[model samples]
Target chain A: MTPDQILTPILDWLDLAGVAVFALTGALVAARLNQTFVTMAFFALVTGVGGGTVRDLLIGAPVFWMQDPWVASVCFGVALIAWFTPQRWWEGDGIEYADAAGLAAYAVLGSAKAFAFGVALVPAAVMGVVTGCVGGIIRDLVAGRPSIIMRPELYVTAAAFGATLCVIGLSLRIEQTVVWSVAALAGFTLRAAAIRFGWA
Target chain B: MTPDQILTPILDWLDLAGVAVFALTGALVAARLNQTFVTMAFFALVTGVGGGTVRDLLIGAPVFWMQDPWVASVCFGVALIAWFTPQRWWEGDGIEYADAAGLAAYAVLGSAKAFAFGVALVPAAVMGVVTGCVGGIIRDLVAGRPSIIMRPELYVTAAAFGATLCVIGLSLRIEQTVVWSVAALAGFTLRAAAIRFGWA
Candidate 1:
């Protein structure tokens, strides 16, 4: 199969999974703030799709969410769930681990997309980091918290590592699965360590 | 001259003026926060270009600042100026009036740019307001202040009025200068009134 044919389903599933996790985090922030359902939905949509929107725009592609009605529907669903559920259910380390997973997937996906769009490697790596972190940054800003990027953390650095690995793999013509898995694993490992050990 | 030819230089001047003033405000916010010169420059560049970057991305235009080196240079210049200036110099209402001018100009410019990109009238008008307000929103978020949008003021309303006027004039095929001047004046007048009289 052509590389596009082989990778399409894999990337699609990764994108949806990443978006769903990010949307949940956004809704949780709204719940923590005691905001209305409308605010929760708004936050979910923005946080889920904000990074990809920035990446696509910077790469001169159409905004991805605009083309997919399902993206908004999923955000709405996440908002509803958060509104109905107890906040305590989502209050522990589980959300942080899930967010790390989403971050890694998004960073890899963003780098791949930028590369596919003919961007240079450095900027593509930057796009990857942006796609992973911008959503959380927007979430924090709207929720009136200090930006995650401003805090001494491994978050952006983990994303950068993932993006750079993806770019390098692609440039070296490595097999797609190995490339994606390794990059995402590296990012997730670093982020999880940061969360678990309270690493600055 | 063709319309593009006629408006290019005029719009260019307005764009530079708006960006410079917004950059100054961003740098001032950094200074107020006791941030370093690097942080001040980063804030200035983001605030100076944030709104137009959003508008361009949403409208599928190339991101504006990336194409122009001078934009970053101007932001750097403004940051240096802010870093050197005393806090007392920027206190009180002078910066407020300058911000008002930038807001009006950005609103008009954003509306015109969106219209030129063939966005529908309502969305174009919305883009105008987004362009005018988003920079300040970003600056506030970075500075840890409540967003100006959350305040009870005529700020966004003034931008809406300007954008609406610009859209109407464009639909009527009015002279470019007339459309731009009237729309900007309407926005500036409202904002100035709000600042002077504490209008809600």
Candidate 2:
């Protein structure tokens, strides 16, 4: 397959992974609310898709989901899983791991999309910041907690660091895969460590 | 008064009124969630402030709340009222009116801010739509419901009409109070009429 063909599928997977992880966090929050299964699924779907939609609209791009139905499909599929699965799987002690994954995945995807759109480095980084945190911000606000903006563990800062690194790596002509892997790792690691140590 | 003095107080009152109205809705939602009064207040403050913060950041302006404490103060005052008042006042009897007020106030402020930032007509309209809708969008997401985006309604369309009128009024050299009064009236009228009659 040509490079153009390869790029589309790779980007799709990254976006899908981001959506799935966000869905998990949404489902978890809904469960915490003791919401019904349908509500849980709906929350997960919105949380999964919300950030990217905002990003596309801001950048004047056709909304990604409207163009490629796969993104919505992934969210729908995750909602089904979250609905049908036994509560124990999500509610178990390992929930933090899933939260960390969601954070990292969305951050990197946000940065990548910005880079793809040729946004300036700073604005791109801000896009990454918004993408990574806004969903969770919305989640916590409705759930009636102080937003992560009020938290001390450097949530947006971590996303910024990873996004900057990815952008720099791309500018320096590094391999795309390597840049994304490193960026995602950076975000995931910071979140994982923070959760483990109760840093926030 | 010079432009700075004249505009500052005007912007402040708009922000205050908008914040209070949005805060009322947030607090009302929290009350419905069976959250404690403190939680309700916190949601009120966040929802009242979140859209403005996001809008400022997007437009490369100082976030209005951080620059002035009065916005937060008004939000708290509104939250107190929301909390101390009887639940039935909001839960059934007054929610529609409060929501209509919110929809109007925020939409006008958002559009005005966009024009102040020198955004063009299309982007400005986009700003108005986002300004009017995003607060509720964020609030509903956090509260876990189908947001404006998912709803079949004239929510955005109403904001568009009001925002467009504001821009056109400005272009035609309409007086400032006249401009905002018309915009707010248009937004409220559109929203209330639609909600009351189940008009889409």
Best by DockQ: 1
Residue-wise C-alpha lDDT for candidate 1, range B22-77, written one tens digit per residue: 99999888787766665676578778878887887788766665445466678879
Q: After superposing candidate 2 on the true structure, give the runs of residues whose Cα lies further than 4 Å from its correct spot.
A: A1-200, B1-6
| Chain A TM-score by candidate, in order | 0.95, 0.85
**Candidate 1 pairs with clashing backbones:** none
Q: Residues B1-200, candidate 2: write the lDDT tens digits.
A: 53345566777777777778778888888888888877887888887887777666555566788868688887778888987888887765367666776767777777677666665554454456666667777777777876664455767677767877887786677887899899989988998898788976
Worst 10 residues of 1 chain A by lDDT: A1-10
True lDDT of residue B89, candidate 2: 74
- Computed on C-alphas against the true complex, the DockQ of each candidate is 0.15, 0.04
TM-score of each: 0.63, 0.55
A130-154: candidate 1 lDDT, tens digit per residue: 7998898889987879877556677
Candidate whose TM-score is highest = 1
Tens digit of per-residue lDDT, candidate 2, span A75-153 = 6577677777777887654766776676676777777777777787777777777777777776666555677878898
- Model 1 stretches astray by more than 4 angstroms: A1-10, A20-50, A57-98, A118-126, A137-200, B1-17, B27-46, B53-98, B118-127, B138-144, B150-200
